[model samples]
Target: MQLDDALHAAFRREATGLEGIDVAVYEKYDRDPCEPIIGLGPREAPIGFFGRDPGEQEVRWGEPFIGAGGQKVREGLYRAIHGAALPDFEASREVGRLAFWANTVPYKPLGNKAWPMAVKRRFQPLMAAVLVDHWQGRELITLGREAFLWFGINQSRETRQALDAFWKRDDRFETHHDTPLQLENGHAATFRLYPLPHPSPLNQTWYRRFPDLLAARLESLDAARRLG
Candidate 1:
């Protein structure tokens, strides 16, 4: 399926599982075209980042990530990936590979509440399909523990052990800490998975090392490309 089609499917699947969420009064934001907030690249890059927004539903135009935590994420992506003081989405595409940006719970989280476990669980398969079908199994980079956990990698003791080892070693790529567990017909192999602490202000401790961690991950990607 095409990327848009796959994305829409995933969105619908996720939305359907929210029956118990009391979304009657909640406003729904229309899916807008993915635009670069900050440089010049293909209007259609395939890589993306997903998250949960814990606030109001109406998203402002020209703004992607929508809160302090989101701002920090943008900062991390900019400084770590683009080597910039602030994010320039246009410039980001020039350096690293990312085509799109999305969220599992695309709408801002209600009352700063965590997403329901059922909603998260139901959304994962659809999310995995979007990654596999649309991006044709391109590289993926997910931030936050929740996203990692949703991807089904958390169930593996080996993967958890790897993450722990990487943490203890204070490794750059943290290759030991995270492993690429395949999903949906080996789509997971197209890229690597880097699960860092959430960029939310709550996790300020992780921000200090964000750049270094991202840089190391990028280097590994480059190395893998060379080897291939």
Candidate 2:
């Protein structure tokens, strides 16, 4: 009946087919295999962030977007809401609670590779429930190309085409656009999406500027007014 119940069921059906999963990564972090590794952080949070998937840090912390790249986004949010530096990673989880979070693939993959399209398609419906039925926010800051494009999954053909066209725009990352989504549960809503380059330290092109870009994205939401 609950979203977690649905996610676990789906994971159970697909677990055997989920290839390239680094089970060692989960074991290294002492993560429970039976526990579903996805969901919104705090209900009705003002901001929501969708990422490509979990990494070592996320598996260890048992929270999406709690890794290095996630920390960058959180620092920007902390600065926007409190006008002060977050001080340390010790507060990263609490800072992350300021918003809702999810990912394309809830679990990590081997060698940090993104999930294949078939896998994404298989889980798209469940992720849709997380966004449409669980998250109360009307907007999301999508990190990376995969995360932004995941919105097109399980949507109407028109919406898929529209999201693709929007991604082609040169200004896609600099501006926010509204996209409609429909879930199997009959939930339908349009969420404004602000795309941002993934903040992974290896992404030399945008890594350094990620914080500044995230600040602009939050300002676009008037995040200060709605949060902390």
Candidate maximizing lDDT: 2
Residue 77, model 1: Cα distance from true site in angstroms: 3.9
Candidate 2, residue 181: the lDDT equals 84
How far off is model 1, as Cα RMSD?
6.3
lDDT accuracy of residue 181 in candidate 1: 46
Expressed as tens digits, the lDDT of each residue in 1-228 for candidate 1 is 234655565565555545444243242444332211211112345434555533442244333354555555555455554445764644433333333454555444445577777666555555555554455434444566665555453235766565545545543337523355455555554345555556665667786776666556545555223211
Whole-model Cα lDDT per candidate?
Answer: 0.48, 0.81
C-alpha RMSD values across all candidates: 6.3, 2.0
> Which runs in model 1 stand beyond 4 Å of their true positions?
6-10, 13-58, 62-66, 79-83, 87-98, 153-173, 176-191, 222-228
Clashes of each: 10, 0
Candidate 1 has what TM-score? 0.60
lDDT of 2 by residue, 188-207 (tens): 88899999999999999988
| Top candidate by TM-score | 2
Clashing pairs in 1: 38-89, 38-90, 39-90, 39-91, 45-99, 46-99, 47-99, 53-109, 162-177, 163-177
